[model samples]
Target chain A: MVSALTCLFTPLLRAAELQSSLIASALWSGDSHNFKRQSHQFSLEPEAILRFDNRVKLTALMRLRSISFDGLAPQRVSDAAYSPLGKPLYMGNSSEFELREFYLELPSDNYYFTLGKQQVVWGKADGLKVLDIVNPQSYREFILEDFDDSRIPQWLANIETNVGEWDAQFLWIPEQSYHVLASEGGLYAPTSPLLLPQAPPVGVSVDVKAIDRPGRLLMDSDIGLRLSRFWKGWDLSLNYLYQYDNFALLYQDRSLTANGPHVTIQPQYRRTHVLGGSFSNAFDNWVLRGELAYFSDRYFLAEGLSDSDGITKGKEVSSVVGLDWTGLENTLISGQLFQSVALNRQSATVRDKSESTLSLLVNHTLLNDTLELRLIWLTNSNVGDGLMRLRVTYEWQDNLKTWASSDTFYGSEEGIFGQFDDNDRLIIGIELAFE
Target chain B: MKYPRLLSCWVGILSTPFFALTGLAQEPLSNAQATLPTGGQVAAHINSRDEGEAVSRKLSIVMRDKRGKTRKRETMSYRKYYAGEKRTVIFYLAPKNIRDTAFLTYDYNTPEREDDQWLYLPALRKVRRISAADRGDYFLGTDMTYEDIKLETRVSTADFNFKTVGNCDVDGHPGLHIEGTPKTQAIARELGYSKSLSCVDRQIWMVRQSQFWDIKGALLKTVTIANIDQIQGIWTQQNINVENHKTGHSTSLSFAEVDYQSPVPDTMFTTNAIKRGL
Candidate 1:
C-alpha cells in the first residue's frame, strides 16, 4: 500500500523538491527495579515544496511512525488528538501515518500570507515555555522530544506585514486541537502526586466520560496577533492570543450507592485570554532574552476528592529570563529561569501558589562539528526536584548522524520531575537523510 | 549587501592586505619609490572605492578536514546598504538538513556601536536574536571567523597599527607587504588575532595573500585569493581558499551568478523576508 501511494505521487513529487529523513530509535529502561528494554521507534518524515514563477510556494510534510515494544506500548496508536478536521491513519496497533503540514505561501514585497496546516511559534525561552503556546503539543514521550517533533501543527491562516519598522503577524486557527497525552498506564504518563487525583476508597468504581472538545470550525477558531521590531540592537515583541486552553479541565462527580461509591470524571475545554511580551538583546558574547505572559484563566484540579467539581479556576502569570554565553570557542552555555504563578490561588488547589524552575544547558561542538555533546539540568525551587539530560551525537557523514542520550529524574515523588524517576531511560538513535 | 562593498570586505579580508596597496595610486611603484603608503591610507582607499548600489550572488563553501573528509554548503546571499549601514541576508539553499535556514545581519560602520544579527532555524520555525560580539568564532565549521567575514574588506585601521613590511613579488607580480598589530589587548582578544601580514598586488590594489597569527603569537591561518575578475566595472574576488594550520582544516569559497545591476529590494533584508525563504 505504501509503495502504491509512493508510485502514485512520484510524478507530482518530481515537480517539487522532495526530501526525506528516516530515523530509528531504541529505548531501554534505566530503572533499578525494572531493568528492561522499553520500546523501539522508527519514523519516516518526507517534505516536498513546489514554487511558482510568481513566488507562490506550496509545501507538504508527512510523517510515519511505527513502534515496537515489550512493556512500554502506548494504548493509543496515533500521536495526534482526535480532531474533527482530521486524524492520523492507523495502520496497525503500533503504526500511524499523518500528513503533518500542507501550506501555500503567497508573498509580496511588503505582505505575506500562508494558508493551511502549519505550526506557529512565539516567545523567546527554550525548554521552559512561557508564551510559545500557539500549537498544541504531544506529551507521549514527555518533554524528551524536541519541540519540532512534539508540536502538533494545525490548520490556520497566517498573515504577516510590515507596519513601519515593526513586523506584524496575525493568525486565524480554526482547527481545534489539544495536547496529546500518553495513556494513564503508559510508561511515560504523569505520576506526579500533585498532578494525579487522590486515591478513591477500595471497591469504588470510576467512570471517565468522553472528552468535550470544541469542534465548530470558524466559531471555535483561535485568533492571535503579534507585533515585533528590532530597535537599537534589541528585539522586542508584543503578542495577544484568544483561544481554548490546550489542557482540558476535569470536573468530577461522586455519588454513594448501595453497591459502593461511584465517581464520574468529565473533561471539558475552557477558553483563555493571553497577553505576552518578549525581548532579547545581545552584548559581546552574551545574549539575554526574556518573556512575560498573563493568562486570564487557568484550571487546576482541587486537592481533595470531595471538593466540588474537583476543579479550581485562577488567573495565571508566567515569565522566563534566559542568557546565552558563547565566549568559549565551540561551546555555548545557556541558562534560563522560569516562574509561573497562580494570581488568584485557591487554598484547595493541588499546586502551590508559585512555581519556579532553573535550567542550565551546555552545548559543545567538537572535531569540526562532526561530534556534538550536550547536557541540560533543570531544577525546581519549590520541589527540590529536577531533570538532568545528556546527549552525544556523531555525524559519520553530512547526511547521516547517530546519537545516544539519557534522561534522569530525581527528588521526592510529589515533585513534577521526581514522579518520573522510575521512568528514566536511555535512548539511541540514528538519522539518515535523502535529498 | 551591495556587491561592490561585498567585494570590499571580501577584498579587504581575503584578497587584500591590512594596509593600502600602492596600486591604488594608479601607478606601479618602481624598485626605488621615495614614498611608501601607510596601512591607514590603503584601508581608506579600499573603503572609499565605489562598487554599486545593490547585489546578490550564489555562494558555495567547501570545507575539508586533514583526513580528506569534505562537506559543502550552498547559499543565496543578498546585500544592500540602508543609509550608511550595510544589511545582508543569506539563505541556505542546499544540504537538506539546513535548507530554508537564514541569517540576517545589520553591520554598523560605527566603531563603538555593536552590530546586530538574527538566525532563523527552519526546524524551530523561529527567528533568534544572536550576539554579534563573538567575531572570532568560526562560522559553521568553516575556517573563516565572523570577524574574517565582517571586517575583512573594510579593514578597521583604528583597531590595528600598520607598518610597511617592504615590497615583494607575489606570483611574479610586484606587491607591497604590510604588517598590522592590534592596537589594544581588548581588540586583540575580540579579534583573536595578534598580528596579520598582507601582500597586495601592485596592479589591482587588492590583497593577493594574507596570514594571521593567533593571540598566542602562533601561526594560525593563511588566506589566498585564487581568482579575481571585473564584474560591472568592479574588481570582484571569485574564489578564495583558507587553511587553518592549527586545526588542519581548510575552506574554499567560490562565488557565482554575481548580479550587480539588479535591484536588491529593501524588503529582502527584513527578518520576515528570511522566513519566507528564497
Candidate 2:
C-alpha cells in the first residue's frame, strides 16, 4: 500500500527538500524465573521527510526488528517466540521491517488532507486507552513495550478543515491490521489455571480448518469523524467511529463425535460502533484530562463455552481520568483511573459485568537533565493483578543514551497481567540517533 | 502511546518563552508619563522597527560551563506578529530527536490576566495549554532562566527606577548608558539582582552591553552584543553572549537568516499551527 503511494507521490517529491534520520537500539534481557537470557532484540528505525514548496510534506518511518530467545539446552527459556505455530488457516506475524508511518500531508489555507499509512490518535487518556482506538496494537511483547512500537498503522485518508474556531476531521480507513497477539506457547502465555477448556491441551497441537479476515470491500471498511474546539482555555472533542473489532472471534464446528462432540473453532471478525469524547484543562503546574467511550455490538467470549457459539455480543462503556503535574523543579508525576462497565445485556456470557483499573507514572531527571529515572505501575482492581516497570537512563551525548530496566507482574492467575507473573524480567539497552 | 520521558525536556524548552513573554511586547508606553523614556518603552522600541513584522531565522543556543566547555543546539524558527495583540510562535528544526516541537504564545496588555501559552508534544500528538510559569528554573538545560529571556518589560515600570546614568562605549560603538535600580530592597531580593545597567547604542537604540549585580551588590552577570547587521533596515544583533560570574558559566544566542517585516499570517499564532508543527 505504501509503495503505491510512493509511486504516485514520487514525481512531486523528487526535487523536494529532503531530510532523514536513523535511530538504532539493541536490548538484552534476563529473567528472574530462570537466571538466563530471556530476550535478545535489535532494532533499526529510519525516518525520512520530504517537503515540497511548503505545501506538502511526506514523512515515512521504517522499523526493522530482530528478536530471538535464549534457547538454553539445559532449560528452555519461556518467551513469546516459543509459541506454537498457528493452524493451516491463520494470519501469521512476520511483519518486521514494516512501515510505521508513510503519509503525505497536503495543507491549504483552511483544510488539510493526509493520505496513506498513519496513526491517528483520538483520546486524552494516559496508559489506559478509552477512545484512542484509531489503530490496532501489537502485543507480541506484551504491554511492557511503548505504544509507539505496539500501535499497528492502517491505510487511511484524513481530511481536516476549520469552521470558525471549531475543527472538523473525517477519516476513511481502507485496510485493517489485526492486533499482534502473543504466540501460543511463549513464556508470557497463560500458566496453570488459565489453561482452561478453551485454551485446553496446553502441550498439544490444534488444527485450523477455516479462517475469516477483515473484508477489503469499500462498504466493509472503517470510517470516523471528529469535531473539536478549545473554549476558555479548555479543549473539548467529540468523535465517532464505525469499525471492526481489532481481534478475531471463534465459532466452534462440532460434528466429530456422536453425543460427545469435538469442537473446531473457526475465527471470524465482528463489526462495532464507537462513540466517544475527551476533555482536558491545564492549570497551574497541573493538567487534567479525561475520556469517555461507549461501544455497541461489542463481542465477548462466552465464559465456559465449548463451541464457537462462545462469542456473544454486548454493549460497554469505558472512562478514564488522568492528571500530570510538574510542581517540582525536575520531577513530574502522573496518574490515571480507568473503569469499564458492561451494559445490562441480553447475553448471559457476561461474568462480572464491570472492571476498574489504575495506573501511575513518575519521572525525574537530574544532572543537568542528563540522567532520568522513570517508573510505571498499573493494576486491575477486580482481579488484584498488577504490572510495574522501571527504567534508569543516563545520556552520554545529545543523541545517545543507555538504560537499565525491570518489569514485574503479580496477582491472581485469572488476571491478564497476573498470568505473566512468572515472566518477570530485567533488561539493559542502548540507543543512538543520527541525522 | 506512552511518551518517552526525555520528550518532556523539549516540552519544557518550548514553554519557556510562551509563558515568560506574557505582556512583554505590550509595554504600555505614553510619551508623557515619565521625565524620560522609561525602560519598558526603550526596550520595546529596540525589540522591533514596526508592528505586524514577520521574521524567519535560525537560532543557535550554546551553553558553557564553569570551565568554558560548551554544548550547543540549533533551531529553525519563525515569528509572526499579531498587531495590537502581542503574539508569536517558535518551531524547532534540528537535533533529530527534538525536531518539530513548537510553542505558541499570546501576550496580553492587561496585567490582570496571565499570558495564554501552549506546547505541542509530537509524541503525544496533542497540543496542551501551559498555565504555569517558573521564573527561576533553567530553560532547556541551558544556563539562562526563563525570567532572563522574558525581558522583564511588564514589571519594568513598577519594579524599577530607570535613568540615563552616563555615556558608555560597547564594542567600540558610542552609546547612552542606562541604569535600573530596584524600587524596593525586597523587590531587588526577589529578582536576585541589586541593580542592572545597559549601554544602548545611539545608532540602533538597542542595548550593546548589559551588566547585572547580584543580591550582595557584586557583579553577577555580564552580557555583550556583537555583530550588528541591517536586515530589512532594522538594526539586529547577530550574536549575544551572557556570562554568569557567580556560576562561572555562560550562554550565547546567535541568530541567522534574519527576515524582518515579512508578511505575517494570523493562523501562525494559533494552536492548530503548533499541532501542525509549522
Candidate 3:
C-alpha cells in the first residue's frame, strides 16, 4: 500500500516539477564501561515545493538518518533462584541506517491532503506530555540516540481544512502497532516470567507474559478555533479531539500469583475524547498566558470496560498559568504554575498523582553570533527534586551547529530516610543539517 | 560752470530723507522665524545618528467567543536605546506586582539584517535569547514589527510629497502637519509600509503620526507621536503609540528621559558585554 501511493505520487510530483535531494552520515563512540557506547549522526533533508499550472501544489521531503552505537550484551542472571529455566538469554547491540521521512503532499486553496509515512505530533509535547506520538517508539537506551530519526507508521492518510479562523483535521492510521504495556511498570522492562497454573508464592512466582498482538487500525478527528481578536487584549484558542482505536487495550487485571482469584478487568473497546482551551495576553512589560484542559476517563481505561464497574473511571482536568516580564530588550523573566487533578474518586484511583514545579531559564549570546549559552533550574514539590542544566551552543554556519550540555538531578523522598546521590550527565555533540 | 552744477546735484541727492529711510528698512531683522531651523535639515540631523530613549504606555486587549467579550490591560515602561550598540534597558513602573522586574536585552544585529536578541531574567538569574522567530514578529503580538522600534529615517528612499496641511498646537507647541507617501511599489515594500501616510511636525520636523495600510488599502496600524520635547538641544519625540485597529491592542512608548549627545562607549555593544549582562 505504501509503495502504491509512492508510485502514484511520484508521477504527479514529477509532472509538477518537484525536485529533492538527500544526504546522511554516521559516527560512533565507545564507553569505558566496555559495554556502553554511543554514536553520532548527520542528515540532509530537502523538499521541493512545486505548483502546477492547474493550481495544484505538491511537496515532498527527502529524509535520511545516520546511526552508530556501541555493541552491548543484555544483562545476564547471576543467581539460579531468579533465572528463567530456558536457553541462556543472549542479546547483542544492533544499529541500522535508513531514510526516516519520504512523503508527498497535495494542497489546494482550501484543503490539504497527505499520504505516506510522516512524523506526527498530536498533542502539545515539550518533553513531558506525548499523548499521541504514535510513530515507532525507539527502544534506544539514550534519549539523544533516538533524536536522529523518529519512528513513524508505515501507512497514514491525513486531510486538513480551514474555514475562517477555525481549522479541522482527520487522520487515518493503517497497519500501526500499539505499544504493549509490560507487567512491570517501567517504560522498557525485561521479558516477562512464565508461571504454571496453581503455583506457590503468589507474589514471588506470579508469571508474567509479554504479548505481541496483531496490528490495528485507528482514526482521529480534531477541530480547532482561532479567536485572535474577539476581545480587547486577549488571544484565545479552543480545540477538541475524538479518537477511535481498534485492538487497543489495557491490562487491568493481571494476577501476580498462579491460581489466584480472577481479577475483574475493564474491557478494551471504547472511544477517547479530549477538550482544551487557551488564552494569551501581553501588557507593557508583562505577558500572561493560561490554559484549561479536560480528558474523559474513557480514554484512560481499557476499551470495553463499563464506566460504573471499571477500577479506574473518571475525568482528568489540568490548568496552567504563566507570566513573563519583558523589561529589557533581550531579557525576559517568567514564572509558571500548573495543576492536574482527577475529578471523581474512581478516576483518582488511577490518577492519584499531582505535582507542582517551578523553573527558571536564562539564555545569552557571546562572541558575536558564534556562541550562545543557556542555563536552567527546575524544582518540583511532589518529589522534593531539583534539576539544573547548562548548555553552550555554537553555530558555525547555517548547516552546522554544536552544543555541550550538563545536567544534574537531585531529590529525596520523605519517610524513605535515605540519602541519594545526584545523577549527573554530560553531553557534547555536533549536528549538520542540510537542504 | 558745468562742474559747479554737478557738485550741487550730488549734494541734493545726499540730503534726500526718503532714500536714507529705504536703506535702513532693507537691513535684516533677527526674529523668532529667522532663528527657527528648516524642517528638512532638522530631519536629516535626527536621522543621522541612532541613539535615544523614550517612555511608553502599552494596552493589550483580548477578545474571545462569538459574543466578542474583551479583556484589556495597560502598563507603563521606560526605554533606552543605543542604536547599533545592541544593549537596551526597560524599566516598568506601573503594576505594583511587577515593579521589580527590569528587562535588559542584548542584540546581535548580524550583517544579514537578522537581529538576535537575548533577555536577562532577573528572578531566574539567567539570560535567555529571544529564541522563537514569532517573538520578534509582532509588537506584543500586534501588527507592529520589530523594525518599527527603530523608526525608519530614510526619507530619500520614499517618493515624498510634503504638503503643509495646516497649523495646529501639539502639546502646547505650534506644529505643522505634512503628509508623505511612497512613490514606488518597490520602495513601499522595503519600508514595510506598502501604503502608509505620515504627519511630520513642521516646527521640530518630527513624525507626529503615521498610518500604515496593506496593499489592499486596509488599515493595519496607526502610530502617533506625542510629548515633543528638547533633550540637550536636540528636538525629539518623547512618546509614540502604535495601535492595531483590527486587534484593539496598542503599544505606546514614552521617553521618560533622553540624552542625544551622551557619549556611549563602543565596548558596550560587543558580544562580551552581552554575556556579562552589562
lDDT, candidate 2, B1-278, per-residue tens: 22222211221121111111111111222444334455555544544434225666677877677765566677655555454446656676767656666766665555445556666767677666554344334455555444454332122444566665445676578765566777788656545567777766657666666777767988866766678777777666677766667777777777787787566677777777777774
Per-prediction interface RMSD in Å? 7.7, 3.4, 30.6
Candidate 2 residue spans exceeding 4 A from truth: A1-14, A32-34, A70-95, A190-210, A251-256, A305-308, A348-351, B1-52, B65-70, B134-136, B145-169, B172-223, B243-249
lDDT of 2 by residue, A1-435 (tens): 999999997887676898899999988888967856567778889999888987689999887766666231101211221112211111123214566789999998878999988888888766658887888776556777777666777778999998777789999987756555654555654343322235544443444544466556587679999989877767889999998877666665545455344566677678889999998877766878899999987766666643246666789899998888866665678899999887755555534688889999887876545577899999988889999989998777767879999999999877878888878899999989999
Query: Least lDDT summed over 10 consecutive residues: which range in candidate 2 chain A?
Result: A81-90
If candidate 2 were superposed on the true structure by all CA atoms, what would the RMSD be? 6.7
Candidate 1: segments with Cα more than 4 A from true spot? A1-35, A70-80, B1-34
List ranges where model 3 is wrong by over 4 Å: A1-93, A97-99, A114-116, A119-127, A130-160, A165-203, A206-233, A244-270, A298-311, A332-334, A347-353, A412-423, B1-145, B148-278
On the 0 to 100 scale, the lDDT of residue B187 in model 1 is 81
- TM-score, cand. 3: 0.50
Q: Which whole-number lDDT from 0 to 100 does residue B11 have in model 3?
A: 8
Ranked by TM-score, the better of candidates 1 and 3 is: 1
Using Cα atoms with residue i matched to residue i, what is each candidate's TM-score against the true structure? 0.92, 0.82, 0.50
First chain TM-score in every candidate?
Answer: 0.91, 0.87, 0.65
- In model 2, what lDDT does residue A71 have? 30
lDDT of 3 by residue, B156-275 (tens): 322333333334344554543333455566434433444544444555555555566654556756666666667666555555555556555554444443554445443333222232
Tell me the tens digit of each residue's lDDT in model 1 across A1-435. 999999997766556553444443333334434546567777888777776656778888888877776234443512335575646777767777888889999887777999999888898888868888999887777787789877888999999988888889999998888887777666667767577676677999889888888878888899999999988778899999999998877688888788888888888889999999999999988999999999999888787753678888889999999999988876778999999998784546888889899999898887767788899999999999999999988878767778888888889888988888777777778878777
